[model samples]
Every structure is written in structure tokens, then in C-alpha cells.
Target: MSEVLESTTTELTPGVRVPLIGLGTWPMAGEEAAAAVSRAIANGYRHIDTAENYGNEEDVGEGIRRSGIARQDIFITTKFNRDWHSREGVLTAFERSAHRLGVDYLDLFLVHWPNPAQGRFVEACEGLRQLADDGAIRAWGVSNFKPAHLRHVLDAGLTVPVNQVQVDPARGQPDQLAFHRQHGITTGAYSPLGRNGDFMASPAITGPARELGRTPGQIVLRWHVQQGRIATPKSASDARQRQNLDVFGFELTQEQLAAINALETGGPPRLDSDTFGH
Candidate 1:
């Protein structure tokens, strides 16, 4: 309901700007996915995150068409599936995604996973660089990568503009975040609300939510934005999507932020390649 959430953007890297709070379209697809995206945009979401594996790019594109927002106004992102790491596979995969999304160029493109077992990371990174050179994607990044993997990209001379990972009130990634900040790389959080239940139930989030007179989701998202990381929350429900974007009106005091930061116990990350069969 706050207007602030509807109108905020963050410069992730030079020439790369994204809505600080975005709608994540993971499991939703088809007409349902399209409708949800359209509704979210109408309600004031300017960034949308999707992946080829999600099977919803076309639907997302349809929604964008319906939203009446200019193509230049929305920051759209999609990813290259790990299985498509071969040189040819990467190009073909992204082209397919772009075609389905009905967009000539993506605001950002990412390597979905490291897939070290496949031994195609360098090749994939090269392919991404080629795409960038050709202007097929405005920016390139990765998801679920550790410091070492990121360093490999850097050493290889691939300037990754952003890295999307899972960060929330319960699972804070301090070391990874510090590494990114040192390198001038932006971080994007996928489950910014800690997959919903965990975030809503955490004392770290609840205490702040109650003290600030805001929802736990808002508190968690504000934490990410205040930390300078981009946060994308997934929800098909219109009201919930709007609530996820309502993070800009309040400011977490330094003490409140520290309280949340202190909750970071260097806990185990909830996401791993094993879980996703990468």
C-alpha cells in the first residue's frame, strides 16, 4: 500500500539497474503465471525474475504485454539452465528464452548454477561474455555460486555484475556478502522472505516487525535493501505480492539492523546443488 515500494530502483552495477524489490516467478506458469505477473506490475512491481527451467517465460512475456508498461520500464531477467552449459547449448538456450519472452534483449542473464561436475563453467562464462558482446543481454551474473567459483570467473576476466543467492533473516550470508562488496559485485536474494514460513516465524524478523509496526516480510526485505542487495520474493497471490513490495516506507534503526544481523549465526544455507539436482 505504500508508494515508496512501487518506485525504487538500485544500481546493481554500471549500466545495470533493477527494482530493489521484484516479483519472482518460479513455480507459477501458463495463463496463471501471466495473470500473476500482470497483476503484480499493475500493483507497482517493475522487476520480474524468471528462468527457462521455470517454464514461464512466455507467460511472463504475455503479462508484460498486458501490463501496458513500456518495455524499457521493466527490468526482466532469465537464466541459462545448467544442463545447457555447452557452448552451443548456452547460446541456443538463451535464444529460446528470449524468443519465448518476446524480448530482443534481457535486462540481465544468469548462469543458473555452477555445475562444477559438468566442468563447463568456463565455457558457459565465455558464452555469456559473447552474448554480452553481441548485446543480447545487458548484464551477466550467476546464481548460487560460492566465493571460489566467483573468483574463478573473475580470474578468467569475466566481470560478473551480480550474484543471486538465498539470503534472509534466518540464513544470512555474511561472508559471501562481504566478498561481493569487496569486488563491487551486486548480490540478489531469491528467497528474500526465507521461503515465507521461516521468515515470518523467526524471532529475528517478528521482533522487528512488531517494533516497527510492519509485516515480517517488510522487515526482512528492508534488511536486504538497506544492506544494498537486491531482493526478489516469489508469490502468485496478488495481496502477498503487493505486501512483498511494501518495504520502502519504513527504515530499520541501526540497533534494529544489528539485532537482525546478530541473528546471523553463520547458519547452514537452505539451498544446495544437491537439492536442485545440479
Candidate 2:
């Protein structure tokens, strides 16, 4: 069963392929988080996302070790927060994340959020590029960055390969996705399920789930994959983790996809990089 229902992958760069469905390790920590990682790997997830703010890097590392999978066989992504937005601070914080994750080279590293108010994200992008060049990280990207932030990075003469952010059926980010496509940046979604319980009640999501004999969460994730974004939906529950990873088996039709797209309400307490935080 595992052999037939394997996970799909996306290549961010030459020789760097990440599984499209990753186990997002946020708000999960300690031994509990470690167990989820191990379960995810055993269930066939090769990509895992972590962050300095998540405070679960060590546990994620422990899970990898427990899985008995070679470190090279897994793709690890860890992010640094705004506190490390400075040029020097970037590398320093990266080293700390690496040390905690117990790895020397990361498959993906990102600036967790664009600290627009600080005005030093460009420097952080350079720092990530240096880390990639130095063989410390295989690929580098940014998260939660708007078009302006992306443009700022590009104007500095660098075009990143990936941008992870909060994208779901509700907040599809159509304009931002178009901008990323024009620039050749792959968009990765964070809150791909748009929260949890209250989110699943939407008729747009439930209708597809019932018709396809899949869970609403699976329907949503399939939507992300079909539209060509790396979807990282976090779940500490082993059952839910495997359930989310099992989305590759089905495909959504054009009309069905459009129906789901029509569910966007445009109100979710937006977090704009331009005026969010420093």
C-alpha cells in the first residue's frame, strides 16, 4: 500500500527535490512532536518543515533519527524569525537552528516572515544565498512576503525559488500567486486548511469531500497540490498526518476546483507584510 500511494515531490532547484506534502512541525514540541515526525516518515513523508519559533527542531531531529532513515534521504526546512533579520544575525540564527536540528546542511531554509518595518530582509536574503553557496543549505526562500517584499529581494539582483505563506481556499492569494509565477518562485502554503474545525464546515469544501469520499482536509490539500503549490498542513495526530499525505491518489476537476475557489470570503484577519511587524 505504501509503495503504491507514495508522496509526490517538487524540485526547487537542480538536485534539490522536496516532497510536495510536508509534515509542518509548528505548535508541536517535545517527545510528542518527535513521535509525529517518526510516524510521518514511516507513513512516507520525506519533507518536514520546522522553525526557530516553533521550538521543536530538536524533537524533529529526534524523530528523523528514530525513523532510521538516513539524514540525506529526508528534506529538512527550518526558518529563522525577524530577530535574525540582520546580515550577521541571519547566519548566527541559522547555525543555531542547524545545531538544534542536528544537521550540517539544510534542504530548505527561509526567512520566516518579511520584517518589513526593519528594512533588512534584503540582507537576510543575501545571507541565505551565501549559506547556500557555502554548502550549508541546499536551497533558500522566504515566507509571508508580499509582492513588494519579493520585488525588493529581486531588485537586489536575486530571485528566490520558493515563497511559503498562508494560502487556503478562503485566502487563495491569486494576485500573489501570479506574481510568483511570473518570477519563477514556487508558492508554499502554510494554513492550507484555513485553521481547523470551523473551517471544515464550509459547503464548498464539504461538498467535494462527500463526492470524492475524502475528508474536507484532504480535498483542500488536493486543491493546493493540483494548483501547483507546496502544501504544508500541520498535524500532530498520526492518523491525520497520514490522511493528509494520502491526497496524491485523486485529482480535482476544473469545475470542482472552480467551485472550491468560489468559497473565498475575503475576511480572515489579514497579516500584511507592509505593516504587520518589525
Candidate 3:
């Protein structure tokens, strides 16, 4: 399986594209992260999304090296940890990630969260800008950012081309998606399947899964891709990883798409950025 040819991509900028589907490695580390990444790569995954908070950068890098693919042939994205959200903190944190990943350059770097209470995310992105200019990073973005947070990044003079956030069956985030469209940023969904095992039980998702001859998860994942959002679903299993990437052969009807989207009930309030994290 040549994942390079089998996968599709979303444009992050002119001439720069990240795979529409990427292998997400969270809640995984050490040997576990290494095994999953190497297997995903061998089974046809060219893009991998990791984070400093995940504590598995070295494992991810080792997995990449084990895949026998050149660094340029793969698209890797990792985020700066929340502890290092300052301008200088970003540079130092990035250095740690790069060193751990054993790569001289990162395909994409993101501020892991917009902890507005900390008040340094804007400067973090500005530091990422300098990194991009210095050729230390290819592109930069933010994760878990809300509309107001995006404005801060933009106001700080950063033109981030991507924003990684939670957009699943139950968290469509229409307003945030609209904001992304208005500002020319692409939305990258962290979990295509809704949380709390709600993904499997949702008729909105399963109905389409049966009719379309795909898994419920596939229906939800495809929905995100069809709507032009980069969907990164995490699984430690190689089979599941490949299944997540194999959704281009079919699409959901507009009605099916809308129905699944209607499952959105504003998501859990805990996940809301206002009370999320510090």
C-alpha cells in the first residue's frame, strides 16, 4: 500500500498540502507509540500528528526511521506543549521536539492550545512565524483555538494556514468552521468519531454506514473529508488505521451528511475552551 498515492490532501498554503487523513498518536507513548506509528506507516500512512504533550516524539521519530521512508516523503505535525507558550519558550520547545523527532525541520508546528488565561499563545505563533522564515518549520497553526483565539493569532501578525480542533459527529462547530472559511484557514479535526462511545450508537452515523457498506466510523470520517476538513482518527490497531485512511471511494449523500451533522448538540461543556485547561 503506497500511502503516498492512495491518500488525498488539503491545501495548507500554496504548494503545500497535508494529507486529508493523518495517523493520530495521543494517549500513546514509549514502545506503544513507536509500534503504532511504524505499523501505520508500513500499512500506508504518510502523515503523522503528534504533540509534545503526548510525550512520544522520540518514539514517533524512531517509528518513522523504521518505516524506511525519507523524511521529505512524510508529512509530520507536532505541537508545542502548553508549558512552553511564550515566544522564546516556543523556540526552545520546538528545538526539543525536533531533536526528539530526530528531524532538522518540521512539516507543520502548532501551539497545542489557546490557554487564554496564560496569555502567550499569540506570541507563540509569532515565534513560529520566525521559525518558518528561518526554514526551521514549514508552516504553523494552533490547536483547540476558538474564534476569539484565532483573532488574537491573526492580530499578532501570524497568518496560520491550519487550525487543529475537535470536530466530531457531535461537535460540528459551524461558527468556528465559518470563521476558518472567512480567514482562509483549514480545519483539522482531532476526532472524527464523537466521544463517549456516542459515535457507534448514533443512528445518524450508523444508518449511512449500513447503506453505504462502510463502518459507522468510516461514515463519520468521510463526512469530515467530504466537507474539506482534515480528519485524524486515532487507533493503535493497524487495521483501524488503514480503514480510517480508506474513505475516498465513496461519499455520503447531502441528506446523510446533514443528518449526521444534526447530531451536534454543542458538545460537552467541559470540552469548551472557556473551562478547558488553564
Candidate 4:
């Protein structure tokens, strides 16, 4: 039988379709990050997610340029840092990000975190609106945002295209997912594979991996896909990078999916929403 890599996509904004699976460049920098990105694109990933804070935008840009993929064929996402949440600061930060990425426009630009305490989210969002109006970014959204914060933004009449949050079998975000669904906003899962060092050792993952003849990593990835959330898994190893995107060829049975979902504890998020001083 031939292996089939399933391709899924969700539209966070009109005319902006981001692939369900993409490469996340976090904690990766320098030449290694660039080479990993190049390998991922060569291995069939069309979407790439990076952030100004990642400090790898230049390397990512180099990788994309070397991938031989047309700029239009790739969906690039970058974020505005927390410190740069002010109105004037946002434009300057975005311009710097674009310059580093070597791109005139970003497919999706997001607010890295909601620092409401700074009392600048509203103004920052307004800056994003201006960028959208100027055609500098094709779409704009937020990451690590809670429902209350999202409501505040919406109440301000700012339409967010998507909300990128931490979602995985171990940390199911049903409320966040529902909120996005209710508001016509797409949800992106940043760490679909629970950062648990022993994620594969868990019965929740291993059991399904056994049934599907796949690795626990693949099982976790498929679970994210089966749940209909966009996921970006990060890896520096070429083998792991390939394994991360190798999720397309198999289908997890409903029973297997339920087994994985049953592992949800609604526990603390893997990423720190409060660390950014929001």
C-alpha cells in the first residue's frame, strides 16, 4: 500500500489559507535553524512560523530563499514582541521583522502575547490594523491570549484572524477552541506534542502508537490533526523534522483518538502566558 500524507488547512482570514502542519522555529538559531528550515521545505512543508523574538528570522529567510520555493508558495508567520506593543513601536518592530525576514509582507503577523497590564494591546492592535490597511501584512492575529483578552480585543471592534495557543492531548483547550469557533477565528496549536520529555512513554501515546504502527510523536501529531486544529511542531534534528511532517500518511481510528483525548487533564499550559508580564 502506498503511504498518503494528508493535507489539511484552515482559513483564519479571508483568502489566507495556512497549512494545518507547519515548522515552528523556537529555541533554534543560527545556521542550524536555517538548515532545518531548508530541510523541512524540501521535505514538503509549505508553511513556516517564526517570530522576531526567536532571533532566527534572518536564518529562516535564508533557508526560504534557498528552498527554491516561490515566496507566494510559502506561508510565513512572525510575531510582534511584548515590549513592542505600543503604537509607534509596533510599526518600527514590524518593519524590523520584515527586514530580517527579507520579505516585503508577512502572510500572518501576530501579537506574541497579550500584555493587557501594559495597557497597550488596544493600541498595538490598532497598529496591526494600520499594517493590514497598508498591505504590509496579509493577516494579523494573537498568540497566548485568554478568552477575556480576546473579548477585550473584539469589544474594541478589532477582528483577529486567529488565536495561536498551546494545545495537545495532555493539555486540551476546549474552551479556547470553542471561543475561537464561536467568534469565527481560527485556532493554531503551538506545542501539539506535550513538551513532556516522556510523551511517548505515556500509555495515552504509546498505546495509540502501537495500534497505528506509528511512533508516539506521530500519534500525538495525528491527534492534533484529527482534532481540526492547525499545529506547528519544532525540531532541529533532520530525522525528527521529517517525522513531525510524516503525519499525513496515516489515519487514527476514532477509538484511538478518544483514548488520546481521554488523557486531557486541563492542566497548566506548557507555554507561560503570564511570563510575558501580561
Error of 3 at 13 (Å): 1.4
Q: Rate residue 49 of model 2 by lDDT.
A: 94
Error of 4 at 198 (Å): 4.1
Off by over 4 Å in 1: 1-7, 196-199, 274-278
For lDDT, the strongest prediction is 2
Which regions of candidate 3 fall more than 4 Å away from where they truly are? 1-7, 268-270
Candidate 1: residue 197 lDDT (0-100): 48
Total colliding residue pairs, candidate 4: 3
Residue pairs with clashing backbones, model 2: none
Q: Can you write out model 3's per-residue Cα lDDT over 59-92, one digit (the tens) per residue?
A: 9999999889889989999998778877788889
- lDDT against true structure, model 4: 0.84
Model 2 lDDT tens row, 154-214: 9999979899988887787788889999999998998788875365777877888998999
- Worst ten in a row by lDDT for model 3: 269-278
lDDT order of candidates, best first?
2, 3, 4, 1
In model 4, the runs with Cα more than 4 Å from the true position are: 1-6, 197-199, 271-278
TM-score of each: 0.91, 0.93, 0.93, 0.91
Model 3 error, position 208 (Å): 1.9
Clash pairs, candidate 3, are none
